[model samples]
Target: MKKTIYLIIIVMIILSWNIAYGEDLNLSGESYVLIDAETGRVLYERNAHKKMPMASTTKIMTALVALENGKLDDKIAAKGECIGVEGSSIYLREGEVLSLKDMLYGLMLRSGNDSSVAIANYIGGSLEGFVSLMNKKAQSIGAINTNFANPHGLHDDSHYSTAYDLALITKEAFSYEEFGNIVKSKSYTADREENNYFYNKNKTLWEYNGGDGVKTGYTMRSGRCLVSSATRNGMHLIAVSLNASNWFNDNYKLLDYGFNNYNRQFVYDSNQFIKKIYVLNGNKEYLNLVTENSLFYPFKEGERENIKLSIDVPDTIEAPIEKGDKIGYIYTYLDGKLIHEGSLIAKSTIKRINKFESIINKFKFK
Candidate 1:
């Protein structure tokens, strides 16, 4: 009986340890990173800051800028510069016209260099003007290490971005509804006068489950560059790979590792009851408090218990308090280090005592 109990206890300890740490993946890429889309938490990364040419993946920003600022229905005349510029093309004929939306699909799905130049000229009024917009957007989105020389990711000594910076750019782009629709599409049928059809160049969209977005790029200098996003179990993940030969395989590996190992656990649901806060000189002596928003943090399985939750409240607050008044905060910590925090708010209003009560107290008090 003693031996059996000891064995059970030992087994439990081992199981607990296993839950706290996830398996490490052998990701194949020159530089790569995986991040939580919602929290911007880095799940895994390797040499993510090494600047390298990104090839046509540069079109992601081009598509994003045009979608956000340019009118979709506006007809843009294809210029001479849009024809036979370099790299890939959707075969935009000189003097042909395409809607802003069609140009986007062509720019993204087909990696059309011609579409990029035409859109840039139409939206920015010049290629130089549009490149400035791309750089500005990159800076605004915390992509500090990125620079763009052209709307398309052509090989230029100065055209470069890091894996991490590209990940940040991809996240910013995903916030737009139309950007999401375009990147995730497998194919696009353009309503051009010539009738155009373009299929997505990002193969992970069809090959991997839950695979949605992003872009792919290739150049002799850039090698193979790819950014991809996926959703699983209510969690969204973005991955970037630069100068990698096995870009698609690496994305799959990183995503599977992220989805299987990490999970977002809600520490406190919105309006969940916490503790009653004392209210001095009010109709009620105390008011119940609760968290204002859902509080969540990522934790590996059995590590949930390691998260310490604490509440801070004043001794007592004067009344006439509103229902949503903040009285305290509940904070979560890991090994005494801060992890996440949420506001503790009053659940109900506490009105001040009547004037008659104040007068009676003043007369009766010794």
Candidate 2:
């Protein structure tokens, strides 16, 4: 027989349509999305999957590819291709040198077109090669709708991404601690002698509470784009806007809606003991089991009442059990729909009792 356990823990799945939990927001973006960074759940969105030019938000992917492939402390020289790039720039002169770390500060904080090229050329061996890396990274991280034509978010008819895709990219970029630190900094001073000072262009870091990231973008072709993130009350949220005249206010409302209507709830910890099961012939009479992974998910108010948990394992097992052995599984469900599943494992090894010990114990009872 299967043993089933039910508990009132928070649970839910990503909604298929706009959920009617908070006030309707008058967001200005042609395409926009707000997501729970911890669970990758979409809280709110409009035209979020429609492909459109994302402007300088493209740098998020650029920085992710470079950080994964290159070292931060290595000094990289600006190549001739990095000179005279259009739009925002830190104004790199050919052969001018800056650490890869400093160049990333320029790429994200200053929105430097030149910095993007410099980092790309050095890390990927060429601009074309680096753009390829960005696309590959995007696809690897499940941002299948994203494409990269250049290191900088310059207008290319072929270059475009969806609001949802941008949010995914930003979430992946934020996974790197250095990436978070760079985007959140108000200003940075490069090791180079001239044009060393750079100030962050993303004003969300200053104007909004708990806003620590991310990037801002504007181009005549792409309009104004912004990808922003905030952490409040132990919840981290990512908001993306494409071609919005009021992106700052739009994102602010979107984030407010999420923070106000939802909360991050802990569901399971890998170290937490699940249950004890009888061991048929072990030296110990029983063996403890624990979850194999931790789980946290965002839940709306009242959803906790519907949460349920189930476990599947043998009622009793033979001895010689090993630690970390996958004995069964724990499944979490909400409203009868499965939301999360975790592995159940033995917490410690249990050796079988020898026949001589068993015979002696019987004699002692007699």
Candidate 3:
């Protein structure tokens, strides 16, 4: 369940399309969006939430499910589910067994539709089961507009996602070190099959600076769908373009806008003041609260006004409070929604007072 955090945006002209203050970017996709990989902020968007065909980009989530659920060394056999799927393939035959690592490389690098079925069947026990995991993962990641009817992202009227949803999915995929490493590789070789080789389809890896792992997709119905990620000067960005005539260029422009125009701004430093908590039945009546880590986020020019910080700490806590106790939270919001948060911890320990100590404290005070 998503809880709303109200933020007062002074600019009202771009509310409906999910646009924050950023450089004016012209893209060639029917639907496209840019987001902060760490913060999930929609730095720029056009028809972001409007659902459309995402084609092979659906494999991003498929790869994510595989990495999260299946062991890399787990041996998966090519079965009936993998036979003659549409689009691209690694040409796996029944009775052939390959490591999950090889299949993942094939799925992302070659966009192997057949490998998708093999993984879905082996890890999920069946195609339907894998599809269930896909949908559940989507919901878990707050991608409400996404639905995965197939693991390989072969076009189905029911299998569709918005640009915003795809970006969210890609960002989540990048969080996994294995997924991130796989997407960025220019080439991958099958560990079991010496002759098998796969090359990354995301052209941005070579054409764009700081290019990392991501996925590219296409179908006649979906046109060209591409999800691209990049890191530059400590800022990571995810760019999604759906039905694009020129996806590589569009993604390049999107990333450039994010890296060149915005920066990661620190709202709270580690050990920063949060609030004073009242203590009951303790040696001290109040305790200072602070954050354990610094909170930093990407923001565009003139967009700092959209960011708001709030501290929600209990008015009073019980005795025996210890240092580093998480008694509250420090939240950061953008456009009236929470973008980041951290625990509010006690700055110092406080001990409880026994009956004898209380009696002695009375005389000492006098």
Best by lDDT: 2
TM per candidate: 0.76, 0.85, 0.87
Clashing pairs in 1: none
Look at candidate 2 and tell me the lDDT of residue 67: 93
lDDT of 1 by residue, 239-259 (tens): 998887889988898888788
| lDDT of candidate model 1 versus the reference | 0.86
Q: After superposition, how far is residue 36 of candidate 1 from its true place, in Å?
A: 1.2
lDDT tens digits by residue: candidate 3, 64-125: 99999989999998887687888898888888899999999999999999999999998788
lDDT value, residue 358 of candidate 3: 62
Q: What is residue 182's positional error in candidate 3, in angstroms?
A: 0.7
lDDT of 1 at 128: 99
Q: How well does candidate 1 match the true structure in TM-score terms?
A: 0.76
Q: What is the lDDT of residue 269 in candidate 1?
A: 90
| C-alpha RMSD values across all candidates | 7.1, 8.2, 6.8
Tens-digit lDDT track for model 2 on 94-167? 88888999999999999999999999999889999999899899899899988899989999999999999999
**Poorest lDDT segment (10 consecutive residues) of candidate 1:** 18-27
Whole-structure CA lDDT of model 3 = 0.87
